[model samples]
Target: MLQIGLDAGGTSTRATVVTTDGECVGYARSSGGNPISSGKIGASSAILDAIESALTRANATLSDVSVIVAAMAGGSADDSRDWLIEPLADRDFTGTVAWESDLLATYFSGTFSSFGYAIVSGTGAAVIRVEDGQIARTSDGLGWLLGDAGSGFWIGHNVALAVMSDIDGRGPSTALTPRLLEALGISTEGARVQGRSPALPRLITALYDMRPVQLAQFAPLAFSEPEDAVSRGILESAGSLLAHSVEAVHTENGPLVIGGSVLAQTGRLAETFAARLAAQGIEPAIVRVADGAVGSAVLALREAGVDITASVFRRVTDSVARMR
Candidate 1:
């Protein structure tokens, strides 16, 4: 029997199928699958389609799968599980089913066991404290309006605000002004805000209108030039904010696993994060979760009765090394 895992996020849904011996058999991808935001039908359809496609690629069927792990976002489990399972069951999936937050994918990607804390810095950010395979506590993640201070959204929103302030002569100019305007496809010189700027484009309006996830795209500006005061300030502030969140739920034991696009990269953010962790005196092992598929596969394989030895994880990691 095969093991299958699905890591569904707001941006995309990924499914992978592997054999009992940690051999990659199939993989599939699809668009955003956030059940909470996209509705149950949309989420389930995306997830099931990916799984079905993976099965087809592997020349296998639902019945061949011994376990199915689904890591997703949005809504109540009670609200979405039936919608998620009925279709799979209709296709004859009689395997053990597991449901979890997409964040768990980051955790599993970082560590084989369910121990350790995970700090997410992707579109939206959150710090999760995991104990014995279960989440113990969560810090921040209040979305863009309320919290998520150190997340991509936070950084991006700040960048946008800075740009607009500079345009209106309310804030000092930063290198991000031109780059941000260019990113938004805005041809108007951002400095025209003090003059006769007629009907500002939607790109300018996006500073107030774009969704939190969309705004998060600007986070890269803060990391572009680490030596710049604006960039350095944002990066260091992000590190400090994330460090505070880590302090809230950090445990004495277990490795500290840093996940998400922001912390995963080797830039100012990564360097400052390391410095902040050192300042906190957290000398535990630090791990990076480069791929969510690896973690999701590890979780499902274990449910399928595969031993989670280090060598096993290494094999699984190697199998999906080409994933991108």
Candidate 2:
């Protein structure tokens, strides 16, 4: 029998099917707008559609699946689980169905065990600490208004504020000023801020579209001479935030895995993160999960009672390598 896993995020939904032996057979993606936000029926339909597409690609049907596990950000919330259950029920998924936050799934699936911490930085941010198979603590994942300190939204928002301040002669000059202008083709702050600035949207889009390539280019902007102050501050500050979260876990042994596009895109962030983690005596073993979709697949296997071993993880990782 096959097992299925779904990693659902705010922006995207991904599903993967894997055999009991841990070989991935198929995968699929769809937009992840919340059902509550998009109307319950619409949200449910999008999720079901993604599941069906992935199952189809695997040359398998829902009845062929022995177990299903989904890791969704904020899925522990009752309302979120409610929105998901009826959809899975509609599909006749009578086998075990497990729903939990993506953070735990990413940690367990990546580490192949049920302990460790995960820090996720994306459009938003949160740090989850799991100990002995239970959630121990979670920092507020409040959106941009209060939290999300070390996230893509935080970085983009700060970049915009810095540019605006520089344009108004209220802040120190930096390379991002020129780079942002060049990338956006904006000649003046007034043109950008007043003209319904296409520059802002383009910058945000670059975060998701150009991704690591574009972020790599911006890393140098963080240091002075050989450094750019604005970029340096962003990396340092974000690293500090991550360290703060890690400290919350207070565990000495870890396979601590970092998630989200921010770490993948910005080497400076990773370097800064390493330094910060070292200061706290936490030497993390980093493994990039690519999209965390495969990790989702592994969780399905675990739920299906398929015994996981080193060889099993290697098989899944090998399958991912082939896909890349």
Candidate 3:
């Protein structure tokens, strides 16, 4: 028998087919499948596409699978199950289906342990404490507008503000000013020669024309200049805020699984976040997961009555790594 695991995110969706012994046999990827970000129809379509492709590659039919575990970015929402039911029904898959938060899957990706902490810092930021393979508590997963203080969006939004402040002579000048202007397709030399008057309006207009989440495009600029005090400050602040979110859910010793672009990049933000944790004498085993689909597969194995011993976990990780 086999089980299917799906990790559905705002940027992409991945499906993995694994045997009862926890060995990955097939894998497939598709576009974004977060219903909140990609809409119900689109998200469902992406998930179904990945699953069907994976099954094809495995040379198996849906009937060969005993269970499916779906770890979705917005799976906790009231109507999230709606996104899964239609797709499964469309394929006439009647096997057991389980829904879980992507956060939990991320934690499992880093370790086989059932208890740990998980922090995600991509376009959004969130922290979770897992107990017995379930989320015990959560902090700061709010969307861009309200919270997500140390998210990519937050850092980029701050970058834009700093640039505007610099142009208005209200903040110190930084290298990001020219880089941000260039990124927006505004002529850097023209902005400098024409003065702040002409540049401010254009910058504002260009920024306003974008979707709020699109501000994440500017996040990389914060790391473009290592010596810029403004950029350094932004990263420091981001790290501090993310650390606080972790602290809010901190408990006894357990692995700390960190993922997403901002923290997994081996840059200033990740460094500062680690430093802050060290400052508080809160040190735990830290693990990094670039993809959470493997974790979802682990969950599927568990649901299918497989004992996830360390050896089993190793087999699963090794097999999935080979597929990647």
Error in Å for residue 148 of model 3: 0.8
- lDDT by residue (1-324, candidate 3, tens digit) is 999888999989999999998889989999998888899889889988998899898899888989999898755555647667867877788789988889988888889888889999999999999998889999998989999989999999999999999988999998899999999887534434445557888898999999998999899999777579999999989999999999999988899999899887667777889899988877989999997888999989999899889988898899999987
TM-score of 3: 0.95
Residue 62 alpha-carbon offset, candidate 1, angstroms:
0.6
Q: Who is ahead in TM-score, 2 or 3?
A: 3
Which sections of candidate 1 miss by over 4 Å? 187-204, 322-324
Let me know the TM-score candidate 1 reaches against the reference structure.
Answer: 0.88
Give lDDT tens digits, candidate 1, residues 88-113.
88888788888776666778776776
TM-score per candidate, chains pooled: 0.88, 0.80, 0.95
The lowest-lDDT stretch of 10 consecutive residues in candidate 2 is: 217-226
- Model 2: residues with Cα > 4 Å off, grouped in runs: 33-39, 80-82, 181-226, 320-324
Clashes of 2: 7
Q: Supply the TM-score for candidate 2.
A: 0.80
What does candidate 2's lDDT look like per residue over 59-114, in tens digits? 88888888877777654344546666777777787777777567766665566755
Ranking by TM-score: 3, 1, 2
